[model samples]
Target chain A: MRFRIRFAQQVVGFFILAALATLVVVLILMGLNQRWFDRGYSFYSRFQSADGLTPGMPIHLRGFEIGKVTSVDLNSNNRVNVVLQIYSEYYDKIKPNSVLELEQGTFGIGGGLNLLPGKNLLPPMEPDSFLPSTDTLLGKNLLAQGLVDQPANNDQMSAILAEVQTTLSGVNLLLNNVNSAIDGTSNNQLTGLLQGVNATLRSLDSVLTESAHGLVPNLSAITANLAKLSAQLQDPKGLIPKLLDPKGSLATILNDNNQLYNEVQSILDQVNQTLVQVRGLTQYLNQSTPQITGVIEDTRTTLKKADDVMTGLANNPLLKGGIPEKKPQNATFHDLRDEDF
Target chain B: MTERKPNLFERVGATTFDLFHNTFYAFGFFWNVLGETFRFRSRSRVSTQVLVMQILFTGVNALFIITLIAVSLGTVIIFYGNQITTLVSTNFVYTILITVITRELGPLLTAFIVMARSGVAIATEISSMVVTHEIEAYLAVGINPISYLVVPRFLGVTLSMVALNLYFNLSGLAASYLVAQFFHPIPANEYFGQLMTQLTPTAVASSVVKSLAFGFVISMVSTLNGFRAQQSTTEIPIIVIRAVGQGFALLIVVNILITLVFPR
Candidate 1:
């Protein structure tokens, strides 16, 4: 039993060692996969902002990750100075004029630095040399299009906070005003005016109701009668059309030349006879002119006496207490009574 | 004679003292085992036999359950991992698997299995030996029980944990691929290539380091609990329960500390 246990132990120990060996091999494989053995050359880039840039973030050429970010530092100028380590194999792809673009993933999921090559065919950039950044273009474009937020420095953030505080104060004031209005503590003139207008509107409503009840049907009936009359006038057998028709009586009278001449001659004869009678009557009036004037004078005298009698009757005490004692017409004179003195 | 009840302060002081005392004892035992592990030339035939026997008991015996749980865990991970393939790239999926299996679950689950199985067994065996006066017999024979028994078990449990964690990772990844074939059906080379690309040395090192630390903790805690047993046979079951519980707690705390210190 002891020997069997010993054999089993040896077998288990062998398996344990094997498992550990496999683990070490896996670690080595991972190191190799990460290019830990590869010789890389470092380059530097300066950006205005290192917003999404981080160490170990891959640097891509086209779509391939040819390098990685080694470090990011804020220089004394408040600019981001980034160090990039590119594999020696891809060193030829770097040019002195190559632009390093710090791009973020869509919806801000991931971000990376991309090397956009320039037109000049210069030799490979020296290790540790500085490369230009696309920060100016990218930052401005992203800020303008609202694709990315602006990096808020201490001063800008403070300014934004101040503005927010001011807005909050204004909102607080507005809320206070609204609360006062709701509680009826502030007697708003507009509210009183609105109430008055509401009362007027109620009166106007009653007036309009009366007018509608009284006038609407009558107006409708009048319009209906007008419409009937218009319909009758528009009928083919109407009087106006009948009168204007060539075969109608008025048209016949207009169309017959001899009859129209005879009618005009008879109308002229009647006017001449009437003028003769008017001349006779004028002669008669000239002969009786004196008598007519005397009769007009007599009639005026009789009218004056009748007016006096009517005035005396109106001034009788029984009628109006001596016509209420006519007001004096004199400028200064008045009868002085003992009580007035 | 009538026993007097301990006051609150006395009870607190006793608890505190026991905590510190047990912590120091476990640490001393760990140090001694570490020293023995390095003393290759001084190793005796009996110690070698004991070490081999421990390896057989802790590691070889636990493989079946470890493999079973690992494969099942892998299948479940891949089943859900494939669902997100449409939203994220397959490379990202591989990264998720590596982070979950290698970085977190692999070492932790292996430690749990070892603590549940071998940890309880070690405590019960040692406590029983103590109760039967076998420990006294070893001392009478001028044998250092710690170097003979505890050191071998320590080395055995720690080595077993590391090996089982490795096996678990391997079997999990393999099983995940098999399950993923039913959903995605990609070539094996392509799948493995993507996985390799996503795997990092830091991640692998973190996993191995975690496994090593957890193994050491589980073994030390279990052995320490075993030694706490008294002459009464009733203490054996209590010691075993304590060993399992304390070993689990120490494993989690140590795992968290290592992850924090070596974040991927």
Candidate 2:
């Protein structure tokens, strides 16, 4: 009985000790949980829309959580009022010019809210003071516009794609046409056209040949005629030179017959005078014939000698071989007194 | 007239040797209970229910306050961590929570809580059973003592620790955001978004695994010490002290192992 009583007392003591230990730990945890004796002040921020904010959300200055969101509620004027449970040590950090923003992020699941501790270090926000809210994305409607303009955007893209496809098809057709042209054949009726072209070229060649044959003779005749004309012009009697020369004797005789007749008369008069002189000479020789007979006999011997010399000279024709076959027998001599100086 | 039991040192040495010998046996017994819980080849609804109940008690019930505590902790930490780290990054409130909370505080705080809350309860329960010879009674009755008592507690705490860790992490993350809203009219929109993106599933999973292992260590050490207690009132305090000390040591070692397994 005594041992059992002692064991029972011990059990009770153990329970008490366990309870005390549990109490101490719980109290410590509770104290740690609440910043029971930490230094800090509080402040209020009024926002139009809290976005997706909740009570336990962190209150960040710049990007750091300076305090906790104690409560979020709608005020009398329908503005969102957030009560901050900030540490007193961080009170000096919140400037009076701080702005709160409900920024919507582009690449995140949900948009977030921000408290921008302002840059102005003029004065700190007083405890429990309400800061005016600014920097809301109130008028921006990109999210709504994205939905409204969806179809037009898609249509634009599709139109561009179709244009690209059409252009590509045109390019392909152009390439095919070029390939046919370069290879120089097509199923189209080009064979007949080629034959016609060949025939035309043959006709052109024949015409050129005929034209050349005809021109060759004409050119030769023209050249020969020109040569003949040149030879005729070289003659003094030719009509061309007579027509071109300046008033020669033929033109002078034709134009002035009286002067030409006077010139002929003067020539005939001189010839008549020469004839009379010759006759006079002959008569004088007859008158002196008898007296000259005796002198002739005496001179006969000298004449005979002269005749002999002439006969000898006439006999040696070889000595004068280059002389003309016949000399002029009509040679006339005039009186020396009658000869003019 | 009687053979005196060995001196205190001899007895202590003998008890230590017995503990070493019985440890593997205890493990084997726990393994069998696990087998029975799952009913590998033969299904047993009763054993499974008991195992489930143990899990619910140790894991679910114990972690009920985790969310509340974690959320509040996030708020307070952000409030303070923001003040210090604001100069570094305005959004660093989330980062601080992620780096400090997920990596260390979430697991460590849970472990410490469990050690004080559950560890003491286990040690006392087992010690009372020892003083009363209930364990001896089970041996005589041809029932494994470890399966009856130790396995349930071990499995319970292990499951609970993991569950509680997840609860704490999720709650801390959510609460940090909620708490931030009150301090500022508009909170940073990308704050929590960035937080979720930064936290990987693997990180959360590792914390769970760490907590599970911690549960096993605390439960096992406390139960083992209780089982080894002589039928003396003075032995209770000693066992309790050893339980807490060994629990902490095991937690540290396990944490190191986890660190080595999965680097920061």
Candidate 3:
């Protein structure tokens, strides 16, 4: 009985030990699975707003999850500060200029922080150092449109409202100016000036019509006369052709050794001298005409005025006393005596 | 006069009372066994002959059926897995296989097999012992029947379950690879490498934990139900049937609970 019991005890012990060993092995394997012994470096990122980001949300680099968010806190600057722990194996890949962006996935699923590595080959960032946070264009647009909450003062909407108010005021001022210009006194003056211009244009049109009517027949007569003269000149046996022909009488006379040509040249010179004298006389007449007319008109006016004065004296006898007598100059007599001496 | 019907409150009270009573009794039995097993100074109470007998009956005897079912299931999984591979990366196929087999199917199928094959045997054997007054004989001889009878079977079934589950996983994965070879024709080394790459320690640990828990429930429920048999010889078969049913139900519930707690 004792031997049998001992054997049973061994069997039970073996089974229990095997199970415990299996559990221990599983624990070790789990530790390996989690990379529990692997060295990890910590870093942080600062976001303006947390959005949907939470602790334990994975941080991915190039689509691979290298770490997880360890903590999310509000910093002094009122930004969300997220701390992360990445495995040391990927330390070299993280540059100092790396930016962490909170990317939202499609269909509202799988949103997380993605690290966008910088192009510069700077040294890896120190552990616990803060990485810069970038707001995606979607996030910025959403914030601008007031679809997302702003962590700080909402200045975008206020600025837009101020601009809109300024624009409205400007439009109001423009409308007022337009109204004043439309209703001011200058508008009536413009209408009157336009009417006067229209009347002047009508008179000018009548004058031009009368001038055109009177000039048309004369111009037609002149043209017909010119045409007749041109026809005569164009005739082969015309007098102008006969005179200008090289073998004609005028041509012979106008030749180099002809007496008649010299006489004709002397006559033409005399005629040119007469024309010069006439041109001078006409210029003198043109210069003196306006002055002569003015003098004559003045003398006539003075005579008429004297006649009027005499008539007035004749009509009223008291007016003669009011007229001043002509005074003789004493200096004239003395001067005449000295001259005579 | 018509029979008086029990009120809703009385019915509810009675049901609640029965539930608590059964729960507490099962918990008490489980606790006692745990305590007795831990009492290392009383190691003589467990018999080696009986432990070996139980392991042989439960573990060795159930191997052929477990292999048959596991291989067939593996073949079906691989046949469908070939279809899935076309849609996803081969790595994703490994992930799906590991998630299905290691996380859910392996421990469950092994538990069901042990329950159906050995659970009824343990319950009926214990019930027969009870009916023949063998337990009374043990008590008269100043031996605790629990230590002599229950402890060996408990250790045997639990340990055997864990071992059988490991075997099931190996055979299942191997047979699946064989079946997959006919369709996809992947090299064995590369296939295993891909599987190992996707396999995680947590998945294996969860599988182990699930099997451990399942084994505990099956052994405890079956042994408890067996010991519930009273003086009637006819009660043995009823107790055995109840043990099988309750063991299966408990294992499935435990599997679901474990899965919920440890999702991939």
Candidate 4:
């Protein structure tokens, strides 16, 4: 029985030893990786919400994890303050003006702190330093509003529709007025005017028809008679034929009228000479006929007047006035206005 | 002396004092057992070998199956934890595994397994010893009964527990790798590096401290229960039951302390 108890103790001890050894191995490995003995300064970041951000979240720079979140706590003001344990090796990498941002990305994407290194050549930030984070600008309402806000454009489109509606309505009113005016016309006045013009045209058509109907018969009759006359003239015994015939009257006249022909020839010669002199005289008269006519008419008038005056002097005792007073023919016209004249 | 009727309170107090004294004696008896096991080394090599073999059977060999079971269990935990945190960087994989194994599973599983396997043995053995009057025979021979009977078991159990814990973790890590590769092939470089990085000296120290505490508790509880074993055969089962129960409870407390002292 005592041996049995001894065995039990040994058994328990065995398990304990195994557990200890494993623990030792695991710890040694972890310590080596973490470089547990390395000295480093701490940094601080303040966030509004540190969702699920526990101690030991790694701090990365350019995707390279260089440190870890050592502690997390909320202040009295409800702001989450995180303490980061950065390795001393990267002390110079962090700038004083660097910005710490708590960037929350799309769904299923965990949020993290993004450290943006500033351009200023500031000294390395001291340990336990606090860097302020920029506030999140894309508020919750912005995206939601942007998604659903299209009513304004719809309203503008409706306004154009209304304008088109008014324009169509105005055109409809003008068309209605034109339709009413055409519908209101009387057939009587239109018929009367048409009748009068039709009657006048019918009368003129009657006259033209009468002229055409009668003129054709008359012209046909005249043309028939003229044709008969022309047939007679064209007959072998016609006057033209007889005149042209050598033994006809014209031929006798020509054969028996040599003396007459010579007389006519002499007359023609005189006529030709006279025609030449007449042509010259006509040209001279064309040049000065008005002056010569005026001189002849004046001499006739002066001789008639002198005879009248001697007769008057011989018949009457009244002394003749000295040469008729000279008077202007346009004496009355001189005072008359051009318009009146 | 006159026959006196003691008051109930006085009787109760007396019983309590008696319990306290017995408890102290039980602790001493358990220590003497460990001392005697060491002393047996100088006395005779054959006896020492026998004792060692006994210790090996009870402490090391008996734990083989449990060690294998625990290793696979640890590996399964690691595999699942990795699957869950794949989105998380691989660096955290080892830390999570080490923390869970050492801080919690290692001490707890080891303590419980030993309590069940060895507690009954101790209780029954000591009860039989009482039934046979071997304790008195040892006392009559001028040999310290505790040193000869209990000390070796204490030393054996404690030492074997530490060794077994190491074996369990090693085997568990190996099994974790095999299983992980079968399920999801984690690159050897990344897995090994991550596993190394997460297992820190602080964690190792804490685990060792916890394992030692568990060993001491299990040894003390199981052996003390054995010392108190009476002649009744039923008392053996009763004591074994209590030893196992107390060992588990104590393991939990020690684990919590370890966590508070050294967190991942």
Tell me the whole-model lDDT of each prediction, alpha carbons only: 0.80, 0.67, 0.77, 0.68
Tens digit of lDDT per residue, candidate 2, span A1-341?
A: 55424353343334334434543543444344345466557777777776766775655555555667788999898878888777765677767556555544333322344555555546777788865455233212322233111112222346679899999999998777666654556543454566577899999999999999999999999999999999897878897778755686566656775887888899999999999999999999999998899887979989999999877877797765544587658548767787689
Off by over 4 Å in 1: A1-6, A95-97, A106-110, A119-123, A137-341, B88-90
DockQ of model 4 vs. true complex: 0.17
Residue-level error in angstroms, candidate 3, position A173: 60
Task: Considering the two chains of model 1, state its CAPRI-style docking category.
Answer: acceptable
lDDT of 3 at A93: 67
Cα lDDT, model 1, residue B226? 81
lDDT of 4 by residue, A1-341 (tens): 65545575464445555556555665666666786877677888777787756676666566455677788899998888888888777778677665555534233233355555555667878888875554423222332334211123222346679899999999998777655545555345445565677889999999999889978998899999999998998798777877799887777777874877789889999989999999999899899989989999999999999999777876665665644666767546564365563
- Local accuracy of candidate 1 as per-residue lDDT tens digits, B114-189: 8898888888888888888898999999988888878888888878888888898899889999988887787887
Candidate 4 achieves a global lDDT of: 0.68
Interface RMSD values for the candidates, listed in order?
Answer: 2.7, 12.3, 6.5, 6.7
Candidate 2 CAPRI classification by DockQ: incorrect
The residue-by-residue lDDT of candidate 3 on B133-222, one tens digit each, is: 999999999988777888888888987888777767767878989988776888986777656645677688788898889888888988
The best candidate in terms of lDDT: 1
How does residue B36 of candidate 1 score in lDDT?
70
DockQ of each: 0.28, 0.01, 0.03, 0.17
For model 2, the superposed segments whose C-alpha errors exceed 4 Å read A1-341, B1-46, B185-189
- Per-residue lDDT of model 3, residues A128-175, tens digit only: 886766654543443345432223322334567889999999999877
Q: Candidate 4 on B73-128: residue-level lDDT in tens?
A: 86778777776565544445565667666556775677677767765576667767
Best-first order by lDDT? 1, 3, 4, 2
